[model samples]
Target: MDLEFMEAHLPLYIEAAVLTLRIAAAGILLAFLTGLITSIIKYLKIPVLMQIVNAYIELSRNTPLLIQLFFLYFGLPKLGVVLSSESCAIIGLAFLGGSYMSEAFRSGLDNVAEIQTQSGLSLGFTRSQIFRHITLPQAVSTSVPLFCANIIFLIKETSVFSAVALADLMFVAKDLIGIYYKTDEALFMLVSAYLVILLPISVIASFVERKVRYAGFGDTSTVSG
Candidate 1:
């Protein structure tokens, strides 16, 4: 298994893990923000903007992430729009994750009962106030678990960043295998790293989902199509 070689390269792998986390974290943040904005626009049925958002969601969700990354990393340069590999990876992942997260957010927004909005309006609440005080809370509660799951998916999906030669966990593992020819050890470490990060997240999401469901925030039938 080339234990000595692994030990010698442990620091490099750790650095790669850190980079992976950085990219994933940044991409997730971007995705959440993008998702929320688009979801809200769609929820409000804002004319041209809604069409644009829908188009983006359809295109991003329907396409492979690898193609998106390649377009940004390679295709853009042909048009003189150069981007670094890291930039391409982060943007690609964010767009891909945002598309899915937007759906989750849309589901949550849809779950907020129409009567709740009407009641808030009857009580003299403006639309914005109603949304801020009533609809948003319920929507967020209902959507939190799905949102968490989406984040975990993106975390794993970050491995694809290696295709662009970005030095993330998968890339580092592949590099180590190339150098030491210790395929088993490299794959083990790669899988272990992902499990270590993802297991706790999945557990926490499950616990939170149960609590939210028990608290009546989750009613699967009300979730959007």
Candidate 2:
């Protein structure tokens, strides 16, 4: 173990850590939005669209991520789906996140009472209006915290982008190991980098979950619990 080399390379590792954070952040945000939309599509069972979204969810969640990256980075361009590595990570993460979010959102929507939609329709609200005013709000509040938990998950998922040679944290760590042969140190640094990116998200998710619980998802009273 070259302590000197490790010390000399700390800055490089930190830079890689920052890049990893950026990648994870971008991917998680995109995934959250995409996932939310797909979840709604599935929950509503929108004719042909719902079935497509269901298939997408199953496919994304069921596949090994390494294969997905290979397909996106190596295979897709065979059919002309070209994207930079970082861009591909965002797209891939969003695709997978959307699929998983659909399941989370469907569960949340199911938690809402069927009567709520009926009452809104009886009050002469259009289907879209009822969804917009009555159904969606409750569904979103119910799902958001859970979705936030998924954000932490999605952040960890971003580490897999190293397969495509994305300079995410994992890639950087592997590079360092290759250079210094301090495999343990490199692996430790990688794990620490992931923790730094993910811990705050978990904490924030917990806070939002508390807020949602207080909002009386069950009560449906004033917006405040």
Candidate 3:
């Protein structure tokens, strides 16, 4: 019930909030690109490369992200790779988020017209151009909703950093609770912290989804069939 102590620690909460945002933003960016590339690889079936990437996605998806974070933070340094907690969290989130994001993109890529590939080939587009012009755009458009959801999931997942000793929002909130013994206030703040981080993404995602659907991912205007 030390409200004063908890109130005084507000600045610490704000700082941790910034760290959480940084981790989520940078991690999502990396995940999106990694997922996109993996999606394309699976879509095109590029032999050994596809197999390797698919195995990675499956492995990461099947395991706990907490373990992944620990490995990056604790174990990787034994191999001469050192990283700060924030860096480790970001890297772990990227891989963890990338695995699910890749699957979302895989399903989206599947939904893209098979004939679009033939159409692009008929138009004399190279493999790269077909992917660039025909496949990626539609696949991404279709994947946006799932991608947005995954981004939110990843944002929430940032709290797992506490296990790795990263002073992210959850970490800071835990400390505030311990110091002030105000469980209600600390819990409310933790909930508010995640709401602040995720609500804007939800809003923006709704807007993008509106536009994408209006443009008609299923309209069948672009494909050659």
Candidate 4:
């Protein structure tokens, strides 16, 4: 590996990583909100809206992020709706990630038994109160691992942002490789940068999963009648 070349390009990778993280963070947040809302709608079975949500979930999950980004950055301009590269990247990530997140949240919400809701109703808990107090907490706790996995998945998906002309980590690495023939160094830095970014998150996700499991959040038996 070219240590000198790697050192010189470190700042470039760092800057790219920052951009990648910013885009990922924004996208992931939007995705989480979208997923939560959709999952809740699905859980509540809101008639017409439920069908719309189902269609959206199917479309988003079935499509690839690169195609989504292409349409956002390239295709929309034909209709005079233009967005910056960053906007396209963020929106594309959110659109793709939202479907996965919805599935994760829906699974968690499904794990919540009907008897729990019945119990809450018998105890004079309002529907909103039951969802807020009993359902949301346990659902979230059960979904923590899935949530973390989705977050990491969204972060990795940021690699494709370069297709939209965003200067993300993958873009920088590929740029360096093409311009300077520093494939080995550029790839090494890319791998190292991702490892640096994802390792801690993986560790924390494992820890949180273990904690949630230990806390009996996923165990309905722990809830007293």
TM-score, one value per model: 0.92, 0.84, 0.87, 0.94
- Residue range 156-203, candidate 1, lDDT tens digits: 888888888898888888887898788988998888788887899899
- List clash counts for every candidate, in order: 0, 2, 0, 0
Models sorted by lDDT, best on top = 4, 1, 3, 2
Q: lDDT (CA) for every model shown?
A: 0.86, 0.76, 0.83, 0.89
RMSD of candidate 4 to true structure, Å: 2.4
Candidate 2 lDDT, 74-135, residue by residue in tens: 99899988878888887888777777777777777776776777888889999999888877
Shift of residue 154 alpha carbon in model 3, Å: 0.6
Best by TM-score: 4
Question: Which consecutive 10 residues in model 2 have the weakest lDDT in total?
Answer: 215-224
Write one digit per residue (lDDT tens) for candidate 4, span 1-225: 889999998999999989998889999999999999999899989999999999999999888899989999999999999999998988898899888899999988877777778989999999999999988887888888999999998998889999988888988989998999989999999999999999998999899888886325435555543
- In model 4, pairs of residues that clash are none
Clash tally for model 1: 0
Report how far off residue 222 is in candidate 1 (Å).
Answer: 7.9
> Ten-residue segment with the worst summed lDDT in candidate 4?
214-223
Model 4, position 136, has a per-residue lDDT of 82
